[model samples]
Target: MTAQGAFEVKLEPQQDTDAPAGRMVIRKKYRGDLVGVGIGQMISKRTAGGTAAYSAVEEFSGSVAGKQGSFTLIHSGFMSADRQTLDIYVLPGSGTDELVSISGTLEIIQKEGTHSYIFHYQL
Candidate 1:
């Protein structure tokens, strides 16, 4: 089944080091067809070309279609200097409890300060 939803996220930057990359943790509350809360950690690096690259992992807990449990999603993508592209998907074998056997790709859209998602998955 496919799940669609909108969410708002708050990001908090963690302690900084001498490295060129910035690290942060994310908290997300979701509404609409999917209801849940998730926490994630992200590391962002700025390339010499002025583009950004990011990697993150998020664990979501709640219910999907009334099935309750938790799962983890892994993300890896980069933003171009002129455009951005992202890849967010469930990590293999990462689903737990009632969420076992879950597999999916989550498409995120952000515009004008609003963030939404279209999740394609099977459980």
Candidate 2:
């Protein structure tokens, strides 16, 4: 199934300008088919060759498609001069309540200053 929603996120930098790893605290509030809040942290840094990479883990709490439960999301992202790749997935064995055993992935879309999510999953 798929759940659609809009979310607002706040990212706070957790390190100085020259920190080897740029750490950030991520907080999100979502509305629509998926009503919940997510808390996560991200660590990213630029390589000497000018490439960059980051990874994050977020826990989402509340309801998904009317199912009362929670799950964790994992994020992996990479950037280079020619391309960028980002992958977000539901962490296995991290589901609770009705969402137990939930598995799948999530996509984030941004348009005109608005952020939305497309979550495709199976229980």
Candidate 2 stretches with Cα past 4 Å from truth are 16-19, 48-50
Measured with C-alpha atoms, the lDDT of residue 103 in candidate 1 is 91
Summarize candidate 2's per-residue lDDT along 4-92 as a digit string, tens digits: 98999999988667767899999999998889999999998898999999999999999998898999999999999999998999999
Output the TM-score of candidate 2: 0.91
Q: For all the candidates, what are their Cα RMSDs to the real structure?
A: 1.3, 1.8
Runs of candidate 1 with Cα error greater than 4 angstroms are none
Q: Which has the greatest lDDT?
A: 2
- Write out the backbone clash pairs for model 2: none
* Estimated TM-score for each candidate: 0.92, 0.91
| lDDT string, candidate 1, 1-123, tens digits | 888889999999998888678999999998876799999999999878788899999998887777888889898988885787889999989888888988999999888999999989899
**Backbone Cα, N, C clashes tallied per candidate:** 0, 0
